[model samples]
Target: MFAALSAIGAFIKIPIGINSAALDTVPALISAAFLPPVYAGAASLIGHLSSSLYAGFPLGPLHLIIAVEMFLILFVFTKLHQAGRNVWKWIFFIVANSVLATLPFYWIISPAFFVMALPGITIATVLNAGIAIVVSPVVERVMERVRTHA
Candidate 1:
């Protein structure tokens, strides 16, 4: 089920070029919401690596960046869930994870990846983060329903 969902998300791209696809963080967020943090992080890592390998991204250092992003996001979500925070708090957490988590990576790799143009990195971060923020509530609600039904 998780793999299928992730595959579907991979194909659903946003119009802008900030690499906003339905695939990137939603699976990670969902896994984090329901599973243990370690499992969620592992799921995220596997899902991303699978997607990248299938889609043909430069997998060298990018894997490290993705691992960091997934771990941070899952850690934040798990902590927030434990703290009994509201949805808005989770949204903020997701946004922070998306931006802050990727910044160091972008900073480190931009010269090699982006030729020193930070705007592309910033734009990608914002768009991906924004999509995650926007999609979070819906995912939460769906999870809630599933939990209730189960």
Candidate 2:
């Protein structure tokens, strides 16, 4: 379900860096709020890959590294949510997605590319995470009702 949403988001992208930014992380973050870590991680991985594939894998095999990074980010996001670190989770999610995600490209790609990409990536991260934060509680309530009804 979350994976599907991520894939859907891939098409609605903002071109940035080697790859583009999309609403991919939104579904992953929302899932992280309730589902186990693995589900969120998988959602994030699928999200990134779908977006990359949509863009014809612009970074080639390097996208695997990005996917793994996304997976780890979602994992930590779930952990933070589980631990009740609401503020920290949002901060880490934005920072990890915006800054940390692009930092590696500085060494692997080029410093110039990283510099060029950071602003777009940061903007996309804030938008994506912000949307997730806003809608997650509603989704949680829906899930709660579903579970109770089931």
Candidate 3:
């Protein structure tokens, strides 16, 4: 379900440098709050791939590398959420997704691309993470109700 939402989000993109900024990660972030690390990671992986595919794989094979990064980042994000480190989880997301994720591309593309994209990536990170943080509790409550009824 979350993966499907991520796929849908792929079409809604904001171009940033050679990549894009999208709401694809929001579903993964929200899922991390309640689902297992692997599940959330899977959603994130699917999200990145779908987005890359939609963009005609502008980065070519490099998107695969980014997909793996997304997977690992989401895995750790879920772990941080599970550990109850709310602040640290957001920090990790911003750093891992916005900074480190772009670092490899910096060397591959150019320092100029990295510098130009950083702000957009950071903005997307904040938007995605903020939306997830705000929505997770509401989703959790709904899930709890559904579980109770079931």
Task: Give the root-mean-square deviation of each candidate in angstroms.
Answer: 4.0, 1.8, 1.8
Which stretches in model 3 have alpha-carbon errors above 4 Å? 15-20
Model 1 pairs whose backbones collide? none
TM-score: the better of candidates 2 and 3: 2
What TM-score does each of the candidates earn?
0.62, 0.92, 0.91
Candidate 1 residue lDDT tens string, 22-123:
355566655555677676666566666665665667657676677667665666676666576757545755455545655665566674454333444355
User: In candidate 1, residue 145 scores what lDDT?
Assistant: 94
What is candidate 3's local distance difference test score? 0.89
Q: Mark the 10 consecutive residues where model 2 has the least summed lDDT.
A: 14-23
Off by over 4 Å in 2: 15-20
In the predicted model 2, the residue pairs found to clash are none
User: Across residues 20-135, which tens digit of lDDT does each residue of candidate 3 receive?
Assistant: 67889989998886789999999999999998898898779988999999999999999999999989999999899989998997899999888987889888888888888898
Name the candidate that leads on TM-score: 2
